[model samples]
Target: MTDRDRRNLLERRQRAAAEFVAWSDHHAQEQRHHEVLLAQLETHPDQLDGRNAMAQQRAWAQRDQHRRHLHDSALAQLRHAFR
Candidate 1:
């Protein structure tokens, strides 16, 4: 590759890396939020108003699945950066 092409590729990779870091941080926050919600639902059932335990659990599961999808997408982006 030409020097200019190489430079552009490197810049793109750097940008992708930075973006992956930010995405990972956001994923971590989501995980923490999920954990907090799960704990509250499990530990303080009475405080959840009329929400049923099964419904609360299902909601958390759905959020967790979405987080996993985000994580997979972030990892794919990071992998593409190396290519």
Candidate 2:
């Protein structure tokens, strides 16, 4: 590969890696927050706030899945380019 092509591939890989890490971090944070909310829902004595947490959990899960798909696709593309 030409130097320019190699450099572009490297840059794309780095960007993809960085984006994956960021999305992962956000997902983790969101999961943790959901856990805390769920825990509170279980532990608290307030019957009024007995809202279902599954909806939020499912939303975050879907978001994470989408992010993972994008990250995987990017890495796969980079790998193909490098080969």
Candidate 3:
């Protein structure tokens, strides 16, 4: 590739890397939030009964799934940018 084309590609890769870092930060925050919620549930099981407990569990699962998806997407983006 020409010098200009190489420079543009490098710029795009840098932008994608920055975006991946941001996504990773958000993903970490989500994981931390999930951990805190789980800790709360463990500490105060009585506070969340029947439907509330089930709902909270489901919410945690969904959050975890979303975090995983974000991680996967970010990895894919990085791979694509490098390619």
Best by lDDT: 3
Q: Which candidate comes out best when scored by TM-score?
A: 3
Q: Which scores better on lDDT, 1 or 2?
A: 1
Backbone-clash count (model 2): 0
What TM-score, over all chains together, does every model reach? 0.79, 0.57, 0.86
Sort by TM-score, top down from the best: 3, 1, 2
Model 1: residues with Cα > 4 Å off, grouped in runs: 47-51
lDDT digits (tens) for residues 33-53 of candidate 1: 998987878687486465577
Cα lDDT, all candidates: 0.84, 0.67, 0.86
Candidate 2 residue 74 Cα shift, in angstroms, is 8.8
- The whole-model C-alpha lDDT of candidate 1 against the native structure comes to 0.84
* Model 2 ranges with Cα > 4 A deviation: 48-83
Candidate RMSDs in Å, in order, are 2.5, 4.2, 1.7
Clashing residue pairs in all predictions, respectively, total: 0, 0, 0
| Candidate 2 TM-score versus the reference | 0.57
